[model samples]
Target: MGCCTGRCTLIFLCTLQLLTSLERQIFDFLGYQWAPILGNFLHIIIIILGLFGTIQYRSKYIVVYSIWTALWVAWNVFIICFYLEVGGLSKDTDYMTFNISMHRSWWREHGPGCVRREVPPPTTRGLEDHAYISVTGCMVEFQYLEVMHSSLQILLALVGFVYACYVISVFTEEEDSFDFIGGLDSYTYHHSPQKTSHVQLKPVYLSK
Candidate 1:
């Protein structure tokens, strides 16, 4: 592999994936989106593994990473669909939180330039611990933001997958080209007969 090709490119892409996964993890944790949090955790770990495999030339690990990248792409696609409420998937559903809490995405209420206004309780009889605040004036909606994140992940995963496959092939070629026996003799560049230089040869003038 050249300085920026096969191995180097894969390593760099995996690093980028790791960073994005971490950023998504933090936001998912803040929003208490349990399912996404778990996914993000796994993504970060696998990305690290991918980086390790790329550096160490471990083909098995690279294979695992490539497989996971495919899965990650699918998972992100589902996220985009869920957020977009496509195929009758509702974002309001508590699936993200595992139905453990009513807490929603942090961006829902605190999106860019969003204002949260407290709603007056209709009755004193039934009031929850948390106040009801309506979010307004969001420059970008939370659903779109979520979709964007997923899109970016998908894009990175696709590129990473290609490079990973290339690296794996490269690793295989390296293994096949090198000979291993009980022990192999050292390589000598001059093992083949050296060519005699014309200047070092006896001149034909000697025939005169």
Candidate 2:
């Protein structure tokens, strides 16, 4: 398990890289404007950190893997919340503008300037609040496929974590009867009969 830790760590790092690459492609296609230098620098830093962690803590790779997994999960939650809150600036749902518009209209209609003003769109409130757009506008909308992909990553991370825990238990537990095959041979031979000696033939030869 220790020896395989490095490979597992690399797999997780590559998954992160793939996600970032997809984000980059989406941003480029949308002609989205971001702080190119800063974004690139951050990407580089992430890669460097992953590589450093892999090299320096290969035996304890589970620690790095857990950190990365947590970060990824947190990032997903952040994206979900940001989109749901920002209305038109949502990164996931497509009907944000329409919903925001209705919300703003309702707000403006009930306000102090009701006599002279129509309701503002819901997004108008976000703009009025001067909320920071952050990195959300550049986020790719979460489609069914994207959700499935992310779900698979989360599942894989969980499986790896569980396996790591099992390995830890195996190492810590003081049991000499560690069944390597664990009844696998029994499963293979399932209902087959056991071999027996032919004692009748030996008896006949002795009588002759």
Q: Which candidate comes out best when scored by lDDT?
A: 1
Q: Look at candidate 1 and give me any clashing residue pairs.
A: none
Off by over 4 Å in 1: 1-4, 123-130, 180-208
Give lDDT tens digits, candidate 1, residues 166-203.
88988887786675521244433343234445445756
State which candidate has the highest TM-score.
Answer: 1
Candidate 2: clashing pairs of residues:
100-122, 104-120, 104-121, 104-122, 105-119, 105-120
lDDT, candidate 2, at 152 = 54
List, in order, the clash count of every candidate structure.
0, 6
Model 2 vs. true fold: TM: 0.33
Cα-based TM-score, every candidate: 0.83, 0.33
After TM-score superposition, the amount by which residue 8's alpha carbon in candidate 1 deviates from its true location, in angstroms, is 1.0
Per-model CA lDDT versus the true structure: 0.86, 0.43
